[model samples]
Target: MISIVLIGTGNVARHLFDTFRLYDKINIVQVVGRNEQALAYFGQYSKTGSNFSNTEPADIYIIAVSDDAIAPVSQLIANVKGVVAHTSGSVPMEALSKHPHKGVIYPLQTFSKERKIDLKNVPLCLESDQKKDLEVLNRLAHLISDHVYGISSKQRKSLHLAAVFVNNFTNHLYQIGKELCEENNLPFEILNPLILETAQKLETLSPCEAQTGPAKRGDLSTLKKQVGQLKNDRLIKIYELFSRSIQMKFSRD
Candidate 1:
């Protein structure tokens, strides 16, 4: 059995804790965090504490804290003998230098406390300083996820950057679309089918191939009309920028 000490109370920690508990081979030794109220959520399933100094010994110590707090939080468990890993896409494995065995187990999926996701579908990115620790992480990752990848720190940083573009930026665009619909007295739900189809198309078509609209077709008249329709200067600027970017991409092709 692989014992784990999860250190955080945030969305990622909660999701992981909920998923790990379901597997019989995984034993959650304890959960550590700074907030007592947040720690209470894990109290029902395992030992929960606010003090890092009293962390329990486990086969793996998974630090699911924020990126900035990773290093300092890791220092608290410097004396422990376990494979210490962090669930960060951008942060490098060196942040856990205080530990003899360091690794990374980044789940490439947005986590929400209220939203339930299938762990088996979520991509798990694994990295480690030691070969043995990598094997251990791989074993643990495979238990919950079918999509596991061994990613380097440099490669992981690049993936995180692309994720921001695909997830964060795309979501912001959705917000803009919703606002436009609301301003015109249209239901935002009207765009749901379009959004779903766009995502589903990615399975078979490359982004460039799936591309459509005035920008892709270079219909200057339609572009002008759309730009003229937007009253908000910020939204207009964003629209024009994206249109220009798309035009330039295909122009080069």
Candidate 2:
């Protein structure tokens, strides 16, 4: 059995805790965090505490805190013999350099406490300074996920940037779509089929090949009409910017 001490009580930590508890091979030794209220959630399942100086001995210490807090939190467990890994996509493994056995276990998916995610489908990116630690992390990752990858810190940074463009920026665009639908006295759910189809198309078609719309076709009249329909200056600018970017990308093809 692989014993784990999970640090942090945020979305990622909560999701991991919920998933790990289901597996018989994994034993959650303790969960440490600064917030007493957040710690209470984990207290029901395992040992919980705010004191980082005195933590339970485990085979792996997973720090699921924010990127900025990773360094300081890692320092608190520098003397541990177990592998110290941070769950961050953009932050480098060196953030846990204080510990001799440092690594990264980044889950490439957006996490929310309310949403139940099938971690088996979520991609797990693993990196470690030590070979033995990597093996251990691989074993743990495989227990929950089928899609596991060995990613370098540099590659992980690039992947994270791409994720921002695809996930975060795309979600903001969806909000804009929702507002536009509301203004037109239409339900935002009208776009659900289009959104689903677009996502499903990626399974077989490359993003460039999946490209469509007035912007990609270079339909100036349609584009102008669509831009003119928007009353908000910010929305108009965003629409124009995206249209120009899409046109520029496909024009070379």
Candidate 3:
């Protein structure tokens, strides 16, 4: 059995703890954090504490803390014999170099405590300083996920940048759409089907192939009307920037 001591009690930590508990081969030795209130959630199922100085020896110590706190937290457990891994995509593996065995187990998905995500489809990016430690991380990743990739720190950094464009930036666009709908007294729900279809097209078609709209077709008249209708300068600039980018990408001649 693979025993894991999960550090931190944030969204990622909670989700991982819930998923690990369902697997019989995995044992959650402890969930440690500085916040007593946050530890209560994990305390219901396993041993929980705020102190990191005293911790039981486990097969792996997973740090699910913020990117800035990763290095300092790893320092606390540097003496442990178990493999030390952080769940961060952008942070380098050398952050945990203080430990003999260091690795990364980054899950490429947005985590929310209220929203439960299925690990089966989420990609798990694994990396390690040692070859044997990589195998250990791979074994652990396969327990809850099927899509596991041996990704390096450099590769993971690029993947994270792309994710920001795809997930974070796209979500911001959705928010802008919602605001536009509200300004015109239209229900945002009216765009739900269109949004769903846009995402569905990506399953069978490449993003470039699935592209549509006035910008793609170079409909300057419609684009001008969109810009003229926007009351906010910020929204107008955003629309103009995106439209220019689309035109540049899909210019015919």
Candidate 4:
């Protein structure tokens, strides 16, 4: 059995703990965090503690803390015999330099404390300094996910940048779309089907091939009208910038 100790009680940590508990092959030895209140969520499943000095021996110590705190937290457990792995896409593996065995297990999916996701579908990116540590991470990753890739720190950073554009920026645009619909007295639900279909198209066609809109077609008349309708200066500027970028991209094609 692969014994694991998860550090941190945020969304990613909570989500991972929930998924790990379902697998009989894996054991959640303990969960540690500075916040006693947040650590309560893991109390029902594993031994919970706030002090780093009290951490028990485990096969792997997974640090799921914030990007900035990863280095400091890893330093605390530098003496442990277990393989030290972090769940960060952007942070470099060298951040765990204090540990003899360092690795990364980054899940390429957005996590929310309120929303539960299927771990089997989530892409797990694994990296390790040694072959033995890589094998250990591969075993753990394959147990929870069907899709696992050996991604290096450089490649993981690039993937993280793309993810921000696809997930974070796109969600911000959706929020803007919702506000525009509400201001125009149109039901925000009207855009739900369109949004779903746009995402669905990516399953068969690449985003570049699935692209269709006034900007892609260079419909200056429609673009002008759309920009003119937006009363907010910020929205107008955003529309112009995005339209210009789309036009430039397709024009080269």
Whole-model lDDT per candidate: 0.94, 0.94, 0.93, 0.94
For model 2, the run of ten residues with the poorest summed lDDT: 38-47
lDDT of 3 by residue, 1-253 (tens): 9999999999999999989989999999999999998888886755689779888899999999999999999998878999999999899999998998999999999998779999988999999979999989999999899999999999999999999998999899999989989989999999999988988999999999998899999999999998998989999999999999999998853
The pairs that clash in candidate 1 are none
Give me the overall lDDT of model 3: 0.93
Per-prediction TM-score to the true structure, in the order listed: 0.98, 0.97, 0.97, 0.97
In candidate 3, stretches whose alpha carbon ends up further than 4 angstroms from where it belongs are none
Task: RMSD for all candidates, in order, please.
Answer: 0.9, 1.0, 1.2, 1.0
Q: Tens digits of per-residue lDDT for model 1 on 1-253? A: 9999999999999999999999999999999999999988887855688879888889899999999999999998889888999999999999998888999999999888779988999999999978999999999999999999999999999999999999999999999999999999999999999999999999999999999999999999999999999999999999999999999999999
True-structure lDDT of candidate 2:
0.94
lDDT tens digits, residue span 1-253, model 2:
9999999999999999999999999999999999999898897855699989999999999999999999999998777889999999999998887888989999999998779998999999999978999999999999999999999999999999999999999999889989999999999999999988998999999999999999999999999999889999999999999999999998887
Clash counts per candidate, in order, are 0, 0, 0, 0
lDDT of 2 at 124: 98
